[model samples]
Target: MANPEQRPIGDVSVPLNTGDVRGFKKEMGRLLEDPLGGAERLDQFLGLNIYTWVELPSILGILFTMEERDMIRHSGMRVWDRDSQGPDQGDQKWPMQDPGWNNQNERHRQNMSDLQWMIIRGIREAVPKGQNLGKAVSEHQGKDEALEDWLE
Candidate 1:
């Protein structure tokens, strides 16, 4: 069996090595490009983390909610308007109104949305029937703590 500490990247499971950041990046890029196959790999990845690190599901859920709020805030603003009376005195466009900045923000929002959907899909597929990622992890932790208490 593979070591519990090793994380799967693509077809192989390996221990995380900060020195091989470039290699990890390359694999992630490849995974992102192939959605169908990537989903399966992502499921495995999330499953491993869900079981191995009890806090991960809650952390990811919080981060995902934060990203959704940020996206909503960005989308709610009218990005094409000028704030002429502001600090630039009409010499410079408002940062949010700048074409480049708006485009970049839109791209970032889209990327984050895609990533969030991918993670949600992966979790739905990876988790067993009648249980979500968060519930499963919480239940697992509860069982462990209960067992410990009983033992003590």
Candidate 2:
């Protein structure tokens, strides 16, 4: 009979981008100073850094994969347009024309909500039953080394 000790821990795979993620954890040490101030700092940090990572191409269904492919797939332009002029479809040069500002703002709000829901769903899916997703740094993690349940 096979020993339970040799069994695999989980079906979920470690995210490919975790190395990039672990780099951001350095700010955590500073968060211990004053939580409110830390939160503000974290907000700034995430504003500058986190979105680009979280909003990966795959996450947004941009490119299908990192593997080489010549053609690209897209559902046409996302911005609303009248005739040929798209909302926020102005060149960045000095002669900037009025982009459909109303439509742009509406799209922005819709996108914000979509992003929030997507993140929440991703979090829910990552953590299966009986798994603690997060805990305090001082929590009593045990010494089980095989599957590392003790680290929880």
Candidate 3:
């Protein structure tokens, strides 16, 4: 039988690498301290690897609990900014105006969204039968707010 600690990505299953996950988490922590650099590092970390993309959500689920995943999403938002404008700077150069930068920014935004979806989906999949997933997450968060609140 396949080890429970191993997750399938693409055509193969491999055991999780603690060192790689630790490095990724370290980069995530840098997001708040350095937005542009952190984003660049995260993009480079993910690269163009199919295996990384396929395994990312599962790796994230293993590395963090639902609450921690939610926090990571929030931290990413603070850095990436949903609109892609990032933190406002009156006189600063607008990197998004460049076609290349704009494309990269959009890709990053999509990546973040995808990761968020995976986290929520994982949570939903873990919910007990007949139990409302939204309520369960809200309760875990210590609130009575709607699921959208958690999503946002």
Candidates' C-alpha lDDT? 0.35, 0.32, 0.45
TM match of model 1 to true structure: 0.21
Off by over 4 Å in 3: 1-16, 27-29, 51-54, 61-68, 71-152
lDDT for model 3: 0.45
Give lDDT: candidate 1, residue 125.
35
Better of 2 and 3 by lDDT: 3
Error of 1 at 76 (Å): 21
Candidate 3 per-residue lDDT over residues 30-148, each given as its tens digit: 32244344445555555543233335556556556666556554544333343345343311211212222221354544444444443333333332345444555555443787777
Record all residue pairs in model 3 with backbone atoms less than 3 Å apart, i.e. clashing.
none
TM-score per candidate, chains pooled: 0.21, 0.24, 0.31
Residue pairs with backbone overlap in model 2: none
Q: Rank the models by lDDT, top first.
A: 3, 1, 2
Give candidate 1 regions above 4 Å deviation. Answer: 1-23, 30-32, 51-152
